[model samples]
Target: MSNLNLSLAMGDYDRTRPIYDGRVKIDGVDPVCMLLSPEEMFFRAFRHQAFDISELSLSSYSISVARGEPHYVAVPIFLSRAFRHTSIYIRTDKGISTPADLRGRRIGIAEYQLSANVWVRGILKDEYGLGAEDIVWVRGGMNTAGRPEKIKVDLPPNVKVEEAPQGATLNAMLAAGEIDGFIGPRAPLCYDEEHPHVGRLFTDSIGAAEDYFRRTAIFPIMHVLGVRRRLADEHPWLPGALLKAFTRSKAMSDAALADTSATKVTMPFVEDNLRRARNLMGNDIWSYGVDQNRKVLETFLGYHYEQGLSPRKVDVNELFHPATLESFSL
Candidate 1:
């Protein structure tokens, strides 16, 4: 039988490197993997269907799935995960010292539907008694001008959102205090450059993130692997095969990371960080599959619906290929 030819667009992550480099091969498939930034990959995938497989923003994907216009059938392969307590930036001079201080303040964001922003908002609401409707949102680019949301969003009537003033960017708006704070995956240039007044709401973001994880046990999923819906429908075996290859690739990555004999990665403190992460998250710290992460998915889904990103609540099983949901025990 001829092997399937498919285009897979994803990030240049350590876990996915083996798949891209051909060290890990998908069964019955010849993949043409393209390593790309999440911003570029997601936009093209969702808007143009430019690839057969791609990384999808969880928030946007959930919205599409719940609305019954799903362009992709997702797998539980979480390509990107982060604790976004550090995503929230506030003006130190504005009398804002805590998460609760964000209420009624104008918060700049690159997109109303950014996955990281969604997670941040959800965390704030769950941990600090703040919700989307509690703050005024200023929507605009992070560093560049005229940035737009990749996916369309229809916000609830109670939430107030305004477009950035003509030619304004969130980085500039936040620094100038035109907006009281900003929240997104990307840090504002002002914060990066150490602008005096721009500071993270959580000064000890890592500590805060760890505490949140301890309380909630959610690492916060950002991007999910998606296969073209039509392709998934026609080829029942494809999704499972892809998952097997990816899971194998992840195993290789984990093995390399755990091998502290002579650092396998270029990053400083790789050994120490790996040990610390394992200590906190246990073995399989970056695990994939539905059964292992149902609570995390359910929490995110609830947040998606609560924030008006998803028109209605969606179940975790509704997002992935049916074949990928379960496996047989030998």
Candidate 2:
């Protein structure tokens, strides 16, 4: 039988570039890979089901899974992960010194269902007793005027959410102090530009993130690799093949990043940061497989349900394909 040809779409991270450049191959498959931004890849994958395999937002995937039969099923290849402590940006003038201070404040979000926001909110609630209902949420794009949640979400009634005023954006709103703060994956443009008043809520974000990890042991997952349900069903081996290939790609990237003689990435402190991460989280810092990440997945699913993104708490087993849940050991 001939190898199956499939379309694959995901962000162009070093971990995935090996697959894009043909150094890593999916078993029994010919992949047509498209390097895309997270927004484009996710919107097309979830909303349109446009690719055979693509990167999916973990929060959005949970929502789809909770709503019943979804178009895609996920493998255990976590394409993106991060500590969301750095995601929160606040106006310095606001008296918001701690996460608890966010209560009764207006905060801007691109979308409430965003995985990063979900993690941030979960962290706030878990670490500071600040629930989603405690704040008034203003929804809009960070730089642009309007942005809709890629997957429709019906949040709990008590959780207040409002649209940004027409012709306004979260970035401008944060800069003008219209919104007390902003929380999402990417920092607001004003914060990046060093606006005097716009600064991260955690002034020492790295220190905060390190402390958070020390306490929780959760390096939050943002994106999961997904295959069309129909395709996975038709070719039972597809999901496992994807998991293998992506894991190999990540290993290659890790090896390159660890090569200190000539740093692989453009970042200045690659070796120092890599040393610190390994010292804190061990060698397999960015691990794949369900068994390795079950706790993190469980935590995110709990948050997803509590925050009203998922209709009900989704099981970690339900979030990934059975084939990916176990593997043949050497």
Which candidate's TM-score is highest?
2
> What does candidate 2 score on TM?
0.98
Error of 1 at 168 (Å): 1.1
Which residue ranges in model 2 land beyond 4 Å of their true spot?
Answer: none
Once model 1 is optimally superposed onto the true structure by TM-score, how far is the C-alpha of residue 288 displaced, in angstroms? 0.2
In model 1, the Cα lDDT at residue 242 comes to: 85
What is the TM-score of each predicted model, taking all chains together? 0.97, 0.98
Please list the residue runs of candidate 1 whose C-alpha ends up more than 4 Å from where it truly belongs after superposition: none
Tens digits of per-residue lDDT for model 2, 223-250: 9999999999999999999999999999
lDDT of each: 0.90, 0.92
After superposition on all C-alphas, the RMSD of every candidate to the true structure, in Å, is 1.1, 0.9
Total clashing pairs for each candidate: 0, 0
